[model samples]
Target: MLFLQNKKFSFSILFLLLLLTFQPLSSSQQLKKNVEFNTSKKDHCQKQISASLLFDITLHGFLLWASMGFLMPVGILVIRMSNREQCGRRLKFYFYIHTILQILSVLLVTAGAVMSIKKFNNAFNNNHQRIGIGLYGMIWLQALIGIVRPKRGSRTRSLWFFIHWMLGTAVSLLGVFNVYSGLFAYHEKTSRRIRIWTIIFTVEISLISFFYLFQDKLEYIQKQGVILGSDLVTSTDQGLSPNDKQKELPTDPC
Candidate 1:
């Protein structure tokens, strides 16, 4: 009986040791869980990076569009239209519009330049970056030229205007080209579509160009219409003084 009791105690102790050695979760499972968690963290980080890049791109593009595309073009149009008008107050109003719009455009451009320097990569390897540098320099130079204008009759005034006109034209052309290049760059970087945006910009430019060309010929077109000269002559005869009528009568000399 004593031998049988020892055998039972030994069996129970061995069972307890076996239970102590067993693990509900293995080391391999814990490693796999850690890897999965780390993978999810990395994925979340990538998503945040993409979102931030997208925001930066959107803001930069908006600034460029407002500055170079919309505001500057409208400013040019206002200045051009102002030249066709003779009223002083109306001319002043157009001048004010042009000045304010240009100032706003410069501010927006400065903002975009700041953002580009801070947020974007400065590799300068692409056409977009190259053109942007030139375009911005030309814009600033154009502003300076506009500010230091000579009087209308001065000898240098003509030269100044020539330079200003050329620079303005170049900047406008280059700005539009840069915008197109930027769209392509964005697509290259983010693999996104830009067809509709391109189309919209093209249509807007076309309308502005149409108005610009049409305004120059508008006066000529108006002059081509028929006039009522007979009514003007009758009105002039009715408004004549009595002495002027007496001078016109030859029968009184007889």
Candidate 2:
């Protein structure tokens, strides 16, 4: 009987040890399950973040290039051809294309400016945004000025032409600056390509305008015995003519 009692006591102790060991293992398995659940949730969140980034890039990238290439140039062309006298009567078809392209360009640019603000308001700031806003306002005002279509003979119309010309030139210069800033900021392969082409075109146009027009004027003044060089080029004020109050030729738009 005493031997039987010892066996029962040993069996009870063994059973208790087994129960304690199994309880801890069960709790560890539950903790592992919780960790796995949290890991899956984190992965899902990361995927969502990636998807949002992709969407913004796809939409904004398309509009950015489209406005730069198509709209700004069209705006300039529209202003240049606003007068039928400038373009002969038979070239009206070309003017029509010019008008249509200008309208489309303005619409696209307006839309793009708004979308850019929506997406990148925080990212783009300083002179870049100010220039863009100024360009947008100037282009819209230019379009309005275009509708009046000034007649060269009328003094009032001539004054209006001066105003339109100044505004148009301002907008064009600001647009070019804005494009330069954008390309610099991005510096992607596409932006670099545009930067190279822009620099080449700007240099070509500048050289042509300086030599063909300004040089001829300078030579004519030189023949009249007026020495000319960088000083005349840097002059801020337009000095009065020999007849100080005489009206310049109506042919000069500015």
Candidate 3:
């Protein structure tokens, strides 16, 4: 009887041990499946979020690049080329075009900036953001300066002109750099291809730069060959000795 009771108790304990071990195995398997399912769902949601982010980034990039890269430079170029036009109406037309384009560019930049703030909810978090903010400020300031241009011969006109020119040039250069930074950021965030865009942008910049240099050098070269003949000779003669004046007579007009 004692042996039978001991055997019964050992069997009961063994059964409980088996139950506990086997139950946990099953529960652990179910838990693992649940976790995997949850992980998969999370991954799917993340993918959706990434897609939306990429779209926003691309849109922002387009707006920024269009404003800074294309519109601003082209507007400035139009103004510069128009200055050489002798027709007042034509010059005015180009000036109006430049103003319109610049305004459009500013609008685009403002849109981009609003979008950024809406999406990111933070500013100056990075170099790109800081530079972009500065660029926008400078661009608006430049536009204001242009609008309030001083009279041509005012005492402050020269200072204003220099300030405007320097500020504009700095903004343009900084804007180009910011565009590149934006491209880099876009690629880093989206892992998208940037080589084609980079190449195209580089080519565009090269063409613009070439045209600007050509215009500048062409003007300089033309001026170099200009013979202001009689007027220049007479101007020089006023400072010369009589013998020097006589010697210059053949080259001068009476």
Candidate 4:
């Protein structure tokens, strides 16, 4: 069931991308004429602000949140797979999805960032441009890490892994803040659906992240013959099981 759901989501995102890409292109001529008509010396700055506002509110806000919603869980899965003691069909599936999702996420972010930068390069003191470059670099570095994560048991690999996690987390949190600021900048003036959907997507991604944080703990408790019900909780004073004792796990993802 989870597999099916993920497949459906992947298709939906692809469809959405296609629609958004083509629809805008189809109307570009009309949009260009409209912009020219609205162009005047007195209103030049206003036009830039309006363009920036539209890109930030529409593309950076909702689309960014939604992309994170779909990508973060897959990313967590990729890391989990790298740490797993045994590989199986599920791990392979996760690898495939993770790679594909990472690429798609980069593409989506690139499109949005390009639109924002082109629309408001000078008006915003290049804040948007800087973010665009930073985000691009982070995403590419993450992709490179994913490609090499299987061999990351080495010292260099471990170093890259740490860097990857730090930068990835920074980018994700920055994206969240950027979206929030965009929303606040247009509060009560933007579409109600955009606000509501962004909130819903954020909450959903956060919950998934929380669950990912407990993956190791859950595995340890299960290996110790404890059921994964509400009854299980970690105790600092208690000794870990032999299975868990051999494994030095890091802190939770959350």
Model 3's alpha-carbon lDDT is 0.87
Q: Candidate 1 on 54-160: residue-level lDDT in tens?
A: 99998999899878888888888889988878778999899899989988988898899889999999899999998898887888888888899997789999899
Candidate 4 displacement at residue 193 in angstroms: 8.4
- TM-score ranking of the models: 1, 3, 4, 2
In candidate 1, which residue ranges exceed 4 Å CA deviation?
1-25, 226-254
Encode model 3's per-residue lDDT on 44-144: one tens digit a residue: 99999888877888999999899999898888788888767877799889989999999999899999988888886454777898998788788888889
* Residue clash pairs of candidate 3: none
Candidate 1: C-alpha RMSD to true structure equals 5.8
Ten-residue region with minimum lDDT total, candidate 3: 222-231
Q: Which predicted model would earn the best lDDT?
A: 1
Count the clashes in each prediction. 0, 0, 0, 0
lDDT of 2 by residue, 17-46 (tens): 999999999999999999998999999998
Per-residue CA lDDT of model 4 for 210-244, tens digit only, reads 77777767768776675433235455315577668
- In terms of TM-score, how similar is model 2 to the real structure? 0.55
TM-score of each: 0.79, 0.55, 0.71, 0.56
lDDT of each: 0.87, 0.64, 0.87, 0.66
Clashing pairs in 2: none
lDDT of 3 at 80: 86
